[model samples]
Target: MASADDVQRLFLQALVSRRVVTKSLARILLKKCVEAVKAAKEDLDIRIPDNDDSVNTFVINLNASLDKLDLEIVPFVDGLTGNQVYVLANRKGDEVAQVASDYSPAELAYFKVLAEMIITAPNSSYCLSSMAALRETQSLKATFTKTHGERVLDTFVARGWLYKSKSGRYSLTTRSTVELQTYITNTFPNDILHCTVCHEMVFRGIRCYTRNCEGVLHNHCYAAYKRARQTCPVCDTPWNGDSEGKLKKVGEGAFVEGQDKHARARRRVDDEDEDEDETPKQEEAPSRLRHRRRGRGKLRPKGR
Candidate 1:
């Protein structure tokens, strides 16, 4: 048993905390609505409104009521099928427009490539290797370079805009995910292309962010592509291509027999630097240590 007041309170809680009903978040709210009713002893006017769609309608109605107060429920995007989510944001703020104006042209273009990579990444990985970014940089050859790209990437890594894996792959961080979701969805409305794997009409899918390859695969097909071949089937350009190529060479349309399983599975050694240090120290005498020992001899005379 739940009251109108209790249902209203739950709506307020949702808007306060999450602000948006992402697919996964929608389930959580639906569960909460149902559970709250069962826990309440007094019945006023509500029980967990049947299902997610119903719950969503309830939320929308609540937002609609706030129209008297200048607040509204807005969908993040239009024309994409399936469950539509409504997010709460103030009309006065206009955050997305303000943020877009803040970026320089180069940085703005970077996000476009990033958004494309995110949609096309296997498992919605939202990650791209540095080598891929370099290709984007090269396209801006008049304004950017490989050195400049690495600096920009490292800066992003430091600023929490991106996560830098030890092997040098860069992925959008949670902060970037939060800030750019609406922007990416709204901006790339027309970059539609086909999935190389299934050869289906894809609104959005995985794009192998290679310099020349730029192969696109359906979201589902990306995993199959990896399992079948680490390299892009069409271009044979590798993911993290600069580092590994035993399986296929760049610009070749053929598969090399053996692929590096670890890189393909992304089971990279996070402690590569530590392991390298230990190996070299164990295998070779420490010249630095010998230098320190020799330099310490002058210090003994002061004690004497």
Candidate 2:
């Protein structure tokens, strides 16, 4: 049997290499690590059991060691898919500290600007069209060119910081939401929106139609919310739009797709694609701590 420490080290290595992984993937990866350790060490002390509780125990011990290094494994329910994910987070430091060492100053600056734009997007789209994002470099004082912008976005998507949808829109991935949660909340306290059902920060989701009520709900949560009642949970206003919350797009009547099987499948595939790069060679720049002063228009849902 492998020692508990050995199992923990093996599991931590896998997590650090991937940076982010689904809970299901973590379970499978952990099983492999334990088996490898058992094959290598014959007389190790401490027998680690193969069970769900064992994973919790491993995380507790690993976090104790990670504390001294200002790093810890964080688990959060993905807002889009509702599947839990784990991320290696930097505690009490810049959210992008780990990746900052590899990127240049201009790259970092462009990332900061782009991130703010996505977060503050009108109607809480929480996404930017690929074309708009590519052209963003022209507005920056930094020496980032359009080609650099393309590469940076692609790299960030590959690294699990961003997700590129089928429509070529870019939005923050669950990894970014978990890692940047504190930063986003603090920097955009008033601008940030939360789901009325789960009460957690929501980037893309449904919204209620009451004129002054700022009620929003994740697509997954909205389904259950609809089954329970046909009114706004916050203001008790009668639900006006379809269950999908098809609000008017910023420039058109485009509707963001709900969390369907296709969306979940795409997210799973994105995670699998990250397997090629065990360790991220480059990452986004440091997130600026200051609040962005910008105007945002409210999204008005069309009545059915």
Candidate 3:
């Protein structure tokens, strides 16, 4: 049964011990200590009034005043001590203490295990077996079963850290890949098609269609000499059994003499057939009967 004066004395002693007795800081610390005492008294089954609007308002103002005071104090401390100033510094001591007070020992251990799994997982892609193996290596009792693993994975998925592909394989996102690449370069190199003969990047090549003659040539070089002459560049045989003569560029009327003679002969035969088709058929009239009458007169004389 400590009196309020004893409590106030102890609170002032704590502030003096910590060397934090600035006016605004003292007010904020006293308010926090009063709240802590209230919580402790309530733990002893003591009933306090449910409403304390004045205290709540005072706490809100105290927090704002403390923030401004910290902002003013940090620069002075940094300038005097040569310490770097960090803007918006995380003063999470109270938050961490509150969370720690709320968590049981078993719950804290489970949370640690969950955090370790998240950190050690490859690209944060994991399974029950992997977490079990990790725990076994650390000599910790694994409290997670397959269902628990599924729940952990589901949480990561909901947070967009993990994804399941159509093939049922779990994978990390592109953002994760960029983060992991900082540790090591993970890429494979490859080569494009290069001509074996010329040792150049083969943009286009001519393949010999002849069996057992796997000849490849650059398009420009093959056309300039070997192809323009209408010969197999490798074998020197006339392509399509045509004479070893230069091929006329397409749209150029440069037929060979032999080809022209054969074409002209064909055209002459066609013209003769057309003439015969155009000729009309002639009809002969019957000979007059004068010869027959002379024969009849001579026969009449013989009869007389």
Model 2 misplaced regions, further than 4 Å = 1-3, 43-51, 92-100, 227-230, 238-304
lDDT of 3 by residue, 155-273 (tens): 44453333444433333322222222222121100111233345332223344545555344444445445545665655555654544233221101111223323423443454354
Q: What are the Cα lDDT values of the candidates?
A: 0.48, 0.65, 0.34
How far residue 92's Cα lies from its native spot in candidate 2, in Å, is: 4.5
Top TM-score model:
2
What does candidate 1's lDDT look like per residue over 1-304, in tens digits?
Answer: 4556565667567754655466456656756765675578444445555566776676677777777654555554211222345556444324444353444556545554444454444433434566665666754424876787677666566654566666555654433433444443344333334457655334324555556564776545664567767777677676544633333211112212222222233212322332344324544557533322221110000000
Q: How do all models score by TM-score?
A: 0.35, 0.74, 0.19
Models sorted by lDDT, best on top: 2, 1, 3
Candidate 3 deviant stretches above 4 angstroms = 1-140, 183-304
The model with the greatest lDDT is 2
Superposed Cα deviation of residue 70, candidate 2 (Å): 1.4
Span of ten consecutive residues with least summed lDDT in model 2: 295-304
